[model samples]
Target chain A: MSTALSQKLDAVSGNASGGHRVNPGELDLSHKVILYLDGISVSFDGFKALNDLSLTIDAGELRAIIGPNGAGKTTMMDVITGKTRPDSGTAFFGQSLDLTRMNEPEIAHAGIGRKFQKPTIFEQLTVFENLELAMKTDKRVWKSLFAQLASDERDRVADTLQRIRLVDEADRLAGLLSHGQKQWLEIGMLLMQEPRLLLLDEPVAGMTDEETERTAELFVSLAGKHSLVVVEHDMAFVEALGGKVTVLHEGAVLAEGDLATVQNDARVIEVYLGR
Target chain B: MRTPLSVRMFQSLPRTAWLALAIFAAIAWIAIPAAHLLLPESSPFHVSAYTVTLLGKILCYAVVAVAMDLIWGYAGILSLGHGVFFALGGYAFGMYLMRQIGTDGSYGVALPDFMVFLDWKALPWFWVGSDSFLWALIMVVAVPGLLAFVFGWFAFRSRIKGVYFSIITQALTYATMLLFFRNETGFGGNNGFTDFKRILGYDITSPQMRLVLFGLSAALLIAVLILGRYLVTSKFGRVLAAIRDAESRVRFIGYQPTQYKLAIWTLSAVLCALAGALYVPQVGIINPSEMSPANSIEIAVWVAVGGRGTLIGGVIGAFIVNLAKSFFTVSFPDYWLFFLGFLFIGVTLFLPDGVVGLWRKLRGKRAIEDTDTPTETPADAKGASA
Candidate 1:
């Protein structure tokens, strides 16, 4: 079983060939697009949460998604992370791995990490243990039971503590950390996996001005090494990231361009100011 | 240089925990047995057979409480059907005990007296190898483990949780109890399996046999406590606790929540079965009543009252509740159920952390005082304040 799983991981890590066929773990990013969603629609009982949404994210690009409430900002992230299945669409990681065919953990294992809107760290565990859990290790039950942190893994956790500015609070329970600290810890957890792409929902929703600026710096630093798709209501935070922006209205992309251009778009203004 | 075995064992647990376990082992293995067997009946120091049996019974219950804690307390899967697993284990062992009766039964036939009474001609197909003590041991673990695996696989795969999960487990045990009560199901109807003559060829009621069983029960409890401690402290245990706290977060971190729940659920069932296997020989009876939904709910109360997450708390809870049960059932038999209900309510409201949590809070306060220099108040003190 372990061998079979390792073989599958190997397939995922190997170079992906150009193909239209759906492969479980293959990702061909030679075309530069890391995530491709075309003609996607999702509904709840007759209400359309996402309607005919199409978006593409380029490799190593940090893209921010902005929209009014119920604009399907959260829904789009849900569809990408396999939290919610679209009724009809083709969603792919790179060009081959089908996102629709995968589950949440499988999507994550395929190297897409998601940070929820709320800061969701394991409150009972120490800050170090929380990061340790998110580290890219074998997640099988028996393997985890006997697993001891290698020196390098320990060093990585320590490094994350310093990076998140929680070095002094490393041993403290995560629940005891202040709200901003918990958000940083969650972001730090996502970073530990060294994910190929990250989907963060409201990354700076509840941070002070200084913390928000630091977070903006952190995301900027992470941009080229990892592709990031950030969804936020904070227009200033999005401007700080300085990325190409997509605005969604009623589950469809209404505007797409640089942040300044999208902000001034007629539909974007109508949805924001008109409401 | 390689570490010595003694050092390694010590490192696995704290020095104080080891000392406590050693003391318990000495009492169970040497002192208790000596008092029961060596001391004269007239002597005040004599430990009666009744006391030994009762303690053994409570030890089995303690093991069950610990197993329940593993799933409910740590994994956040409150299984109200744990009694099903416990009773299945008891019935498995009880089958072998029944077969051991052989010609000694009331009917003096190859079949158990129940079969003769029912006018049945042959043993049921399910009882084929049940006469073998080894097979009984295997079934004691396997039956409950398999049931839990299958049940958890389906329920967890579908993502059933919280009170809904609890309701389904209660229903499962309720259904099993009803099935066992039917005579055609071949579990001896409501009377279940009883009237044991021997186990491994020794008279079941002999002092030597009873003492042996009592000693084994104590040893198993300690072993389970140690095993439970090791597991909860491991990374796997950390993940289980994480699932309890935030299951969706666990999934987002690339863990299949179902798989973790199923693994722990199956393990917890196996532990309950082992406890049940020990229980039958000392209690000398196994009945469908053992699988009643109320009994399983009581198992949760024991863990909750003792402190859910603490491994030692489960053991302590089992002993405390059952000891009270023995006294109340005898002294004030009619009010015992009401008393139990009140105790559960009291623990839920006033002692949410159980006895262990209470102890920790007190110790935390004392430690703060001993420091003499006050810095920031501890997190536990904050909890106490709240």
Candidate 2:
């Protein structure tokens, strides 16, 4: 299983591979907004999880959502991806498509991919098949009957494998991989779909320190090219993601700023850290 | 324990294996009939009286087994109304057989012996043209297919799932059983249709005709098993498997599961009906008893006992269970029910996937757990830099 030419990044600059160190002042955010959530509220059995929560993510922006347990972070991901329809709200994708009206599969087809707290790569398939199957959706009886990956598809798959750093293990069954490898494989699966927006829930929750550091590096590289909304509780991982942070308390945004600015905010401390 | 023979066979030259299956089927088709014709009646290769009847019944069961595996093993649908589908097919074919017996019936008149015995004036509107084998064959396929479509449409659209769905299917079969039991239904009132004269003008009593039907059944069984195996390996097969593990996840990946579920479900029912159509003639009777709730439940136990999700395992399961059934009923009539119950419990507890599943679990689990590797998360700096 050789690496594909397209997704392979050039050699690491001394220390970091695929790590593109960015200067904050160079960010150009005047582009069109890709995702807009307005006046959305959801309740489960009389418990309000999202109360009039509205937020926007411009194309290529990586937004971090940090909150305590049950602050509606996961629920928010569900609403956007169409897993759970909000009771009332307006969620738009690319300034037009009414997301609230669409179902999960429709939203997925419309280009929003989500990775759950636990990685869910197909365990029975090989790593290469995991990515290849993710890219294929022509599930007709005959089409599936004669499925064979094209040459460019082969190249793209090889490229994705190298990008995920699993090119050497392409033929290996995914279930045989480590927990962190499983997580990466699932992320790779989501990438194969080429989603415009990604909703990742606790992507680094259960990983070794090294795996966590590597994941932080991966998210940093993924942010601008694809608008990403990452929900995590790890402060160090958050520091690695250096950008505007939205601190959630109960079901609404308590504070939004740079990591240092939000950490020092009295209200943020009162609800989150609680001196 | 290394790599299962079937998986290795499928992996090495898949097209060649398919060719082999086709060639084997062709040989069986010609050789069995030819052996019965050319070889002496006492020859070992010649089809025997006992073997002919047994093979016909086994063929019918094979069709039903394939249908069950399609829904339960592939589409993640566990149906308990398959017996009803089979009976509907039998009744369709039975009507033709009853018509064939016309004027030669017990009372010796133009009425079915049951209608004559029950003192009916004329044929029921539904029974009209059942005298034609062509019409009966069409009904045999159509009735079960239509019922399945309507049932699956409502069940799938509403998104009923899990054990709840299985219970509902059981209830449907139970209801149909009650409907067909009444004396007023004109379906022979418990003592179902028998004493057939002919089918399509061929003497039903002939040993040669019996041998032909048996050969057809054996060949059909082998063919359906091959088709089932092919289906579960394809991309659509992956979708169905994904649906089984996580429906919401698969739906998020852009597959409307209802359509796929319903399509496979209806196909399973139709196959069961075809099996039933073939079954009634060889078994020498067609009755409402075939639609019993208990019978359908038994089929599930058969599949579970064989191992689930592996297509061919269901066939082995059916043959073993039913073969044991015939022996137990004759040898130890009082212990048959208890023996089956114990077998079901044992399989569920120790071999949840069936025999093949148990074997796969032991072998595949070791292979998967023995190796470990590092995670492959991309360590790029693009997102961190922002």
Candidate 3:
């Protein structure tokens, strides 16, 4: 047991040599798809939240999922992140890891990071501590109890602070940040894990126009390095992402293509973006 | 080189806290014992035996309160069954104390008086090692710690939390209390373990012995406080607070909440057990009444009244409420319950942060007024939110 743990620790530390960003130890992306879901269905009290929802996100590809209220956008994110178990279907990450078999933390440990619709950073902790808590270090009880942040880990956190534009507010309590700032801090927290796949739920729900544009830019920049599945209601933000868009009407995909292509689709127009 | 444990333990605390702790240790270890043992009986400054025992008992309770704060205040697990752990600790030590009676008991048999009264022929399998002080000390921590670990494992794995968790814990202690009340349980039934003659061959009721026990209790309380402080301020403590605030969020960030909760829960139970073990010797009795659900709720009340999250607040709260209880139970025994109820309600409603928070607030306001600086408003706002 001791040898097994030490070997696991050695593997993790070996991967850490690349930089502060945790390399998830070479994901088996030979299948070309980072995430694949087919015939996924989740029902709550006989009401289908996701029904036969089949979608695949390619490696390092950015995808936007847009839909009306109760259209299963958040449910899809939940299913992908292992928050909600699909009643029937296959959800795979990196061809081998069955996401359906995993729990939330396991899914997260499998290099899938998620941002909740509501900014849920630790409000009681400082902005720096918030990012520090999210760092890709040992999550075991004893390890965390004795673990100190290495200089590289500190540098990574400092870098994330600048990326999230919260450098000035690093020492401030996270609860005191503006709504837009809180959103960025939460994103920064996700980035600290150095996930292979990022699932964002309504990244710009309450952001101002400028904030929304900046978030779009952030997503665009993160796309090639990280697979991003951005679910949003803002059309301009989707266009700004300049990626394939998947539209959902009920629990299934209504249309799939670019923003203009989806906008022009008749079924998409009839159920959503009414002409 | 890795930092020493001593430095790491005191890293989060200011220098004044260290000084305060040192002063407290000096008083507890030296001054109080000196007053009780060395000072002239006619001297008003001399500490009385009753006072020593009372303070000693309260110190044990303070340790329990500190334990309570760790799980409830930091980990967001409200266990109302902590009395089970405390009583378990007491029973473990009580077994040794009962053995120390050593043919001096009522029936003058090898067995305890209660066992002889029940016509028990021999010690139960569970009581095999009860005669050894070392074994009893091990039981004091292990029994409660093991129970907590098993209970927390099942409860946390099933994701039982919030008021449901609280209710189940209450049920746990309630059931244990009922079980311990039965004569067949071999725990002295309702009377539990008492009538001790000696501990380690020292006269059990000696003033010097009492002072030694008192000193041990005080030292344990201080140790627990420092340990609790170290834990709550470490990275582990930060994650614990995060779990308290948002459990699901912690899960999404790749942390197993159950493990964290279970670890702290077990640790807290062990602390409570240690407190209990110390308590039995000073108080001279261990009974099923300690496992009563009401007793466990009182433990929560001490943490709540003291200020839950602040480590020191727990010790302070334990001292304040127990002191009040000691005073009121004697002065107005009939109205003591009413006073305690009012105190709990008052703290919950008006002083949500407890006495510690109230102190900080007054000092904060005074500092702000004295400085008359506008820049301090943001800092105050941040403090208030945290």
Query: Which has the greatest DockQ?
Result: 1
Q: Supply the DockQ value of model 2.
A: 0.26
Q: Global CA lDDT of candidate 1, please?
A: 0.86
Clashes within 3 Å, all models in order:
0, 13, 0
TM-score of 2: 0.85
lDDT of 3: 0.86
Number of the predicted model whose lDDT against the real structure is largest: 1
TM-scores across all candidates? 0.93, 0.85, 0.93
Ranking 1 against 2 by lDDT, winner: 1
lDDT of 1 by residue, A1-275 (tens): 33455465445444344443445465557667899999999999999999999999998899999888899989898999999989999899987789999999888877899999999999887788789889877788978767665555667888998999999998777888999999999999998876789999998888999999999999999998689999998888999999999999999999999998997788788888884
B76-99, model 2: which lDDT tens digit per residue? 788877899988888888889888
Model 2, A12-35: lDDT tens digits are: 111132444432212222225778
Better TM-score candidate (2, 3): 3
| Model 3 residue A44 lDDT score | 93
